[model samples]
Target: MHRTRRLVPAIAAMVAGAVLAAGTVSACQADQKPEPEQSAAAPVVPAAPTPTPLPSAAPGTAGPDAERSAWLGEQLREIVDAQHFDDVVNAKTGKRPPAMPNVDVAVIELDDTGRPVAAANTLLTQKHPHGVAVPVTRDLSAPGVRWTHWSNSVWAAKKSTEPLLADRGDAPLEFMTPYPASVFKLIVAFGVARLADRGGVRYDEVYDYRPRKATCPDGRKPGKHSVSWWLDAMLTYSSNTATCALLMMLHERDGVAPMNGALRSLGLPTLRVVNTDPADGGGWSFWGLTMTALDTSRLLLLFTEAPGTLWRTPKGDPVTVGVLKRSSRATLRKMLRDQGLNQALSTANWCGQDYPAQGIPHAVPKRWIDPATGVVHVEDRTYRGDVRKCADDAEVEFAHKTGLVPSAGADAGIVTALPGAKPRRYVISVFSNLGCTYVDFVGAYDGACRYTEKLATLGAAVDALMTKTAGRATATLVSGG
Candidate 1:
């Protein structure tokens, strides 16, 4: 979704007011009693006795999952090679297939030591993501076993990269943008998760935040709510206020440099830490956190992985803050199912419902369950463009976030294909603009959903690819261990 810096006072004011209203903060009551600042980094526990590596599952049934996993590495390339995935844009449609236009894919395979093993790339119409390349003679077999750094790489995405930024500390990956929460959220989430371990805070307890009233920059009442409230807000709602509050907490703990440091740890070589808060950081400036499709998948995987790395300060001191280890991982996943982020959906207000809050009846065949209340819904609202956006509805359930800006309209998120059958999940991120209007391109108002549907199509294709891969792996007969 296009993260427009523009503020809609009506929505902002409502949220600020709701924070102090107490009753509306039903999720959890904030501790009105303030406490002294807690500054100590959570004490790190010594690694538990590294149990002698558990004997690899006796290679018996189904060709070892490892072989299958390994085979997939090659198979993926084969799939890319085998397909007539015309790297050409559809002249009639101007649509780029296989990889998006001006996109880059950075795959980092880790070794047994949690260090980088293999870093390969399949660039689209370029040398590196942003015209920067540093070739290294990397070993695939000796990939870093410590997945921590690898996980962090994906979490940071294309923004701030340092360690792996330049080939020889020179030609670095130049990101002329800020880190998007899509990437930073995972980094920060990792930090929080590790902190939870030290503070003995439960994942469920994290949601126990109350949006206590505070001074907001726009001079709204109670200004804003507590940072804890923002945890859920950012994770579920992607609230800017929550992101800033969390950033404030991080800055207090590690200073401003840590944010940049985390970016460097990953090979972004470009992520920047804004010196000032967006509210106070001058009107409408960018923080530069945009990332690619692959990076997005990586964050999802790391947060889902057990024992992932969280963050390390620029001083090389590690502060256990990755929340991936907590019960909340599952908590957050369930929250996703409950439509946690669906709060905005209820409001029927993206780009102020510029176009198709709901979708064209025949256009969008999807489902929506109220995150606040488990209610199925259909969005049929339209704004800015007076034209009817959604004409009809199909039986399929589709719940996703939509983005629109000048010539760049996108929609990304999970789709529950075959709603009854496990909601056979798929992720889609589409971007396109054909005959797009300026307003549609600026704040991402291209209501056509042309690119959004592309994402939907890509997701469906990937799911099929993975499933087919799995089926072949499972079907292969094995005779010996």
Candidate 2:
């Protein structure tokens, strides 16, 4: 079932890229039915720039005149190499993260013009290289980076298999990997805000969100919510119901075509959103979303980077049109900061909880529907509890989104080196599909869970790397480790 559904999006992505390159997207012609309009209170504001064709370099290399980028990449390479991720085991669970995990990582500094370039490096895994350094703004392409048909550069490998070009040497890696859930919320959030920036949608307008697929927390029906309310609910709480409503709204406003256009206009061709509606018998809800670590890092920069550094056109011309407005960026940042699902990447920021020998039994509550009555019931149960790893003292604020399903775990965000700390910032995006198919929250949250622990370790390492580079002697990185 999953494989079949996955194929649909892959096919759609191929077609969408083709249509986009021709300067006419047939998908945008999504039955122009009468749709609700934005409230009159907010005015249209065209903001920043258009997405442009980026230059490409080989994995683990930088563009012209980018020595700093090379150094940063080297720093990131050392951090990942030190972990020995593949063999690492959680002491509590006594389980490895993934016998074979599909993973991709991108780390790029955001201090400069926000052009992602770092040292070229790769990690050797028992199965394959843990990652090929396709620095966000460098490499990952041939003949240069083009948004159209970007998938041609992807390095798709079966578990424990090497890339076909591994022996030949020069292979441009594609960071745009498919994610089942969670991480794509960033794209959804970006879509809503981008539409608002273009004046086609307003955050203040109210929309009705009916609960259908997932059961409500207390059997409460979700009624009408403002666009902003729904955005907050979808982003902060990871609410599928709210996300459905926003997707419906985007579909009604001429489908995913507009959002794709906005993405391309912003210099991200690898990032695309397909409207997969279960009501249309699509089988899955958010599984149609796809993107790369590099693209995600670039997208996050739009929220925090100076306007001049955001984006440019294919012709190298300044793009003042179709950019995210300042107001929208602030709102999105606030939503990210308020994210409730902080268990993954932010795990390093949490203080550890000591558990007794009994292993801290925990009562887990869940709401489910009976097949016979279509009614929701809450089941309270207890299970072996997990202990938190000791938090790090790396003083940084991570405003980001996390995506997790049994098959995958990911976190992407902007890491700010606390206020009054010389103003250092960077972006880190990670997606690891460890194939941990836990059926329930308790199983997924088990203290020794591989994905969770992996995320925490990666976050901590990156945090440490950032701290070490800051020369702690002069900068006051607040103690939050």
Candidate 3:
């Protein structure tokens, strides 16, 4: 079931007053912070007002549930206040805060049966000093793997059956960005999977990454690889070129309209798939291709829950609800489990890991083809180092996806708490558009690292809260005036 809560005007006013007062204090003390001043990039463009109506349950449930919701709302307000303080400090010091100055978080705790025990959406509505309001930004690059509209679109198009390929008739797919491997690979994988299901293309079928007639600004070609290899590279390593190749193949086969139609069918008409990837060179804003944390959490629930239960088609038709087929879900889950970038949510701290030695592979082998010479070059791409570990050894299995670009960092997934008698599983999605730029610092990117640490701490706190409150009749925390 879907529900939303709108802060009553008086509560909103009080919260805003407290946040702004804190913001003022931070602004005055900005001179104390250190910095290698970077020009302020454009602030996040605020998301359009959420269309989901306020919760109707609030009026009737005046005792425990109401108190719990109010407590959660207060916590959210405090978080927003902290963010505002960071923003003010960053504005004064001209240094990017290691912690995101602005962020949007959604946390949901689900029972064994997949019913939500508690859920919260905290969207920061403060404006930057430059006057731009931070939108509920979701330029969650790697995290996109979890709920890419295209994946659902492909499933809808094929209707859980074989995919039929329509003729492209000579339309050339232009490269939108210099880097399209990750997203392009997704496009291609879905297309190929569709074709494979229909007997048109085999997963092992090797496709030439020849940009022969395609409009490629960088004039890059894909290395010779099978469809399956491309899919693995895209999902595992997040290869941009691999994503591009897949997008081109999809354009050649069925075109973009089907994907858009699929999004609408899945009850997410606003989630757009305009370009292949960010590197597509389209003057498109990354936030334009975004989703709210609430929507994202719901999508994750659909993925983790039983099939044919939670979602419906746009026409109110009962479509098979699970986002992925059982086998496909297993494959996706395996990939997510094996994902090495655990810096965001499943950090060494939250889900304990061996630091630089165990987290991300030092160097991942990558191959790129030059379009001009038709030559393939193999190279090793080194990843960033692990920053910090959790203070306590927490044995939590988080099957998650992390997305990070210069402007944003996001981590979303299913959290399975294994330490207790009754293991708890829930979904947590955190998206941050902090003021910190991604510098090439291993653990020294203090601002970014701090932000991540805060996020992990928040996750841990929420997990603990849920664990303590589980099976309790009422929330234990008393509401303060």
Ranking by TM-score: 2, 3, 1
Better of 1 and 3 by lDDT: 3
Q: How high is the CA lDDT of each candidate model?
A: 0.30, 0.46, 0.38
Tens digits of per-residue lDDT, candidate 2, 1-481, equal 0111112101100000000021111222111111111112100011112212222233332232244455555556555554334432222233333333445566655433333333223323333444433343333212121111112112122222122112223433322233425667788788888888878788999877654543221222456989999898777656655666777677667646877887766556656665454332122322235666666776776776343323344444443312678899889988876655455556422233221111001111112223343332322212222222222233556778776543456778877765554444567777654323311112333433224344454565565555444431121111111
lDDT string, candidate 3, 237-354, tens digits? 5554555565565555564456555555665543444543323212223322444454556555544543222434535544332444555555555555544445554444212222
RMSD after CA superposition, every candidate: 15.4, 15.2, 15.6
Q: Which tens-of-lDDT digit does each residue in 1-481 have in candidate 1?
A: 1122223311110000000110111221111111111112100111112112212213232112343233333433332232212222322232332221232223333222222212223322212222222232211111121011111222223223233222433333332221122324444544454455455344443322222333212222222443345565555444444544555555445534544554455433333434443322111112233344333333433333222232233344332214245464654444333332221112222212422223211122123433443333433322232112331222223333333222223333333333333222323333222112111122232323222222222233333443332212222222221
- Per-candidate count of clashing residue pairs (backbone under 3 Å): 61, 13, 26
Ordered from best to worst lDDT, the candidate numbers read 2, 3, 1
